[model samples]
Target chain A: MQEELIRKHRWFWAWADDREEAWLREMAQQGLHLGKAAPLGEYFFVRGEPRDDVYRLDYVPMSKKDEHYYQLFKDAGWEHVGEMMGWQYWRKLATDSQADEIFTDNDSKIQKYQRLLAILTIFLPVLIINVTNMGVFSLREKYPWIIGLQVFSIFLLVFYSVVLLRILFRIRMLRRR
Target chain B: MAGSDVRKYLPLTESTYYILVALSEPMHGYGVMQKVEKLSEGTVTIGPGTLYGAFGTLEKAGLIRMVKEEERRKSYLLTARGRAVLKEQITRLAIMNRNGQGLLGILD
Candidate 1:
């Protein structure tokens, strides 16, 4: 039989990885399994018989270059589905015990979100430079389109800042537990 | 030895304690996971993320070191410092258990 493939345009924020995992697991339950994931929320899934599969995403920026990283997960009964950016996609058979969580402890879960926050921090300076150097007021008359673009960029900068703060709060909350 | 230096890492978290105990003999990440589960009688199951992060933290703290690599699977063993920390944690737990057990008689 030929392979049936489907593409989905769903976007998830940095803090919504758990939601993404749940959505992928839900898709698997409906006989659609995630295949290749592209940037900008593009996901390719292959049609297959519905099965109980638990999907997990781990944010490990440095592990992409390490062979042992993938091997470790593979040895632990998780299949390396694919990677979107630095997030590693893994799937395992859902057992009756529901013990397939990628992070078993609050500290490790906090570390995962910290890694994400670190990445976003790296981009913050570049966005700030663009917003300041571009000078929306100066470009408002000569280059009106540039002003609109600047406003959109500022919006994105604010959005990311809020996300970064939320992740920080989450880490703090985890640490308090 | 730096007893005070290693004491901070003492009272190892349940996952870290199990991981350290499992690495008493050299073992890889997956091996550690399986051994921990077996040793804990399925009460403690360390996931990949927790295991990986634990390995890195332990290695950095000079408690564990990579002993060898087999087919890209890095095997780790507890260092002398690691063994000391584990012993200290076990001692603490033993004391706690004795006290708790004594109280159980009174409560009953």
Candidate 2:
């Protein structure tokens, strides 16, 4: 599954699975229009005209009231300005206070930290295993101690991956909230 | 509680004020959006995401509640608290307007 996703896109949004794809399809069905096709989570960003600003709405769906707010903003002369995956929206503020609201309380930084952990979880174990494999080949005998350490490291890595996956799921749920 | 009044609740955002004003009618999400835009003279365009975020907050605050739902769409109405807030805002605006006009000698 991962291989297929990597083939289609240079980067995977996170992971690929049939269920994930189905849910993404449902999100698209709700109100989103994808500019380009890739994989379940992989999205291609595109820039459009000044009138119709392009945005790739991720799995996150905007609420009904926020939709009203955006319309009000658009009515107030805030044109389609820019787009980002689910986070960025073109807004023109009537008041300085309104503009202040945009910069405050962004969770993206924390999300990025979590993503860093995910990358470590994915790569760290692989590194340990490759190093152990090389050592075993050079030694010409699988030392019992080294074998036990390698097995333990692999198990730890698998456990770390599961925990990272859980954290990612929690973040997704928070986005829904 | 249902009639015209201006007190008890206060400190409403412009978006919330407009939303409550629009919800005075039986308007759905798109309907409320349209009315707000029309009333504001096309000065505000609330995206769908932001609308839902506000709805979640307002509904949780007991200022608004979901009145109807159809398929994936929903309509919300102001609660008594929401109406009170709107009334208070109106009274405050009125007072400020009167004082400013008197001070500026703009009233006839």
Candidate 3:
């Protein structure tokens, strides 16, 4: 029964399988290189008792291809299961009520806070510079060195902002790791 | 460790050594961790981050490559260069063992 199932499955291509071997030979005979974009074969996952069976047919398209076999599966009435990164799996849900639950981690408060801080770091110094310059104009009436001091403050703020941004960017990259 | 002993592994870090040792077979990250722990008798414990970092470095250096990847796991295999490095490390360890035992002069 297992041998018959494997023989019937389209994904179970073997060198000894005359049909697949002939197909490969025909393609080669056409002077077309069997590039990495062809379907390698397919397989199914069936476990547990015969009465209560679960079937998951898996297909590997070429060495690193998927679109072709995916269309093939779709045409055969197989439902698409969620992919694991680039590796995809398809399953026909046994019943209407049965659904596979895939886990995904949502962004936490700490991550959100870090992102917010990163954005704030970008504009914080510009806001500081604007406020300090405004103060310089307003206080110039009473203080003679107000403009000079404000210019120095602007430079300091710019330097601080650059340093802060660098540090924040580094932290963000580290957090991503 | 002595300077000469440390200098033998110019590129491979301690973690890389542990990883290569673990990959003597095609083992996944968690399996590698378990093997390293067992081999060291619980002296070294590599966290996921550190182990991945070392793995990335070893892979980039062409000392290891992915053998297989299953659900939530990836197994690695050592390259020819990796095997050579492992051999050299073992030889160094053998020398160190002999030297220490010779110094002790204790009868087995």
Candidate 4:
């Protein structure tokens, strides 16, 4: 028999990972364990007995998914929940002997943010180049919709810059600790 | 690699320290985690994330290299540089231990 799954929609910012973890843990406490997260901001959960579970969101650095990476985490007992937008969701039932946290030291945590920064640095430039290559300025005279595309591209450039800055600030704060 | 190169990784993190020590024999990620816990007598625990990240950084620095891969698990062994780095760390730790022997003396 198929277990009925519950779906929920919510959004989280890159800097608000702790908030995301809290919200997911709360969902687990209410017996709605995460089954999969897909299509962005949509969380599918499997209804089960209410229990304490810890959720962690990890950003894998490489563009390609490494099975070895998952296997290592499995070795340490973190069950892979689902991934959305390159952030891996890991769940571990709360236990006295097992560790609740995923990354142990500040250096590893800093490296996580560093990996995110690397992705942004790679994509942000590609996006700008692609937008410019679209000839938005020249095409706008013939195609008015090109102006809207230009505006959206500019907005994304700014959004990417802001997110980059926020992550840099977060890394600095972690170093201070 | 002793004068400055080895000292660059001096004062290794507890996890890194235990990891290098454990990799005296090639071991996989899960093996390293279990060995670290035992070596530290349950005091220092290396979660998978830290260990995996350390493997990347260490491998990149030529301090550790993957010697075997099987069943989706890669086993790593310390390089000559890794051994030098570990020795430098031990020297510093030994000095600290000697200078702070009062605690051990008092306890004994």
- The iRMS of the candidates, in order, is 1.2, 7.3, 14.3, 1.3
Better of 2 and 4 by TM-score: 4
Worst 10 residues of 3 chain A by lDDT: A100-109
Clashing pairs in 3: A11-A41, A11-A42, A40-A62
Q: Which sequence of candidate numbers ranks them by TM-score, best first?
A: 1, 4, 2, 3
How well does candidate 1 score on lDDT at residue A165? 88
Q: Provide the lowest-lDDT 10-residue window in model 4 chain A.
A: A133-142
TM-score of 3: 0.39
lDDT by candidate, in order shown: 0.87, 0.52, 0.51, 0.88
Candidate that beats the other on lDDT, 2 or 4, i.e. the better one: 4
- Show how many residue pairs clash in every candidate, following the order shown: 0, 35, 3, 0
After superposition, the stretches of candidate 1 with alpha carbons farther than 4 Å from their true spots are A62-64, A136-142
DockQ of 3: 0.01
Candidate 2 local lDDT, A30-71, one digit each (tens): 433234444343444332223222222223223312444455
Candidate 2, residues B1-108, lDDT tens digits: the string is 334433433556566678788887665666766687688776664544445556666788787888876655667888887777777788888888888977786545
Task: Identify the candidate with maximal DockQ.
Answer: 1
Higher DockQ: candidate 3 or 4?
4
Give per-residue CA lDDT, model 1, range A119-139, as digits (tens).
779999999998887775645
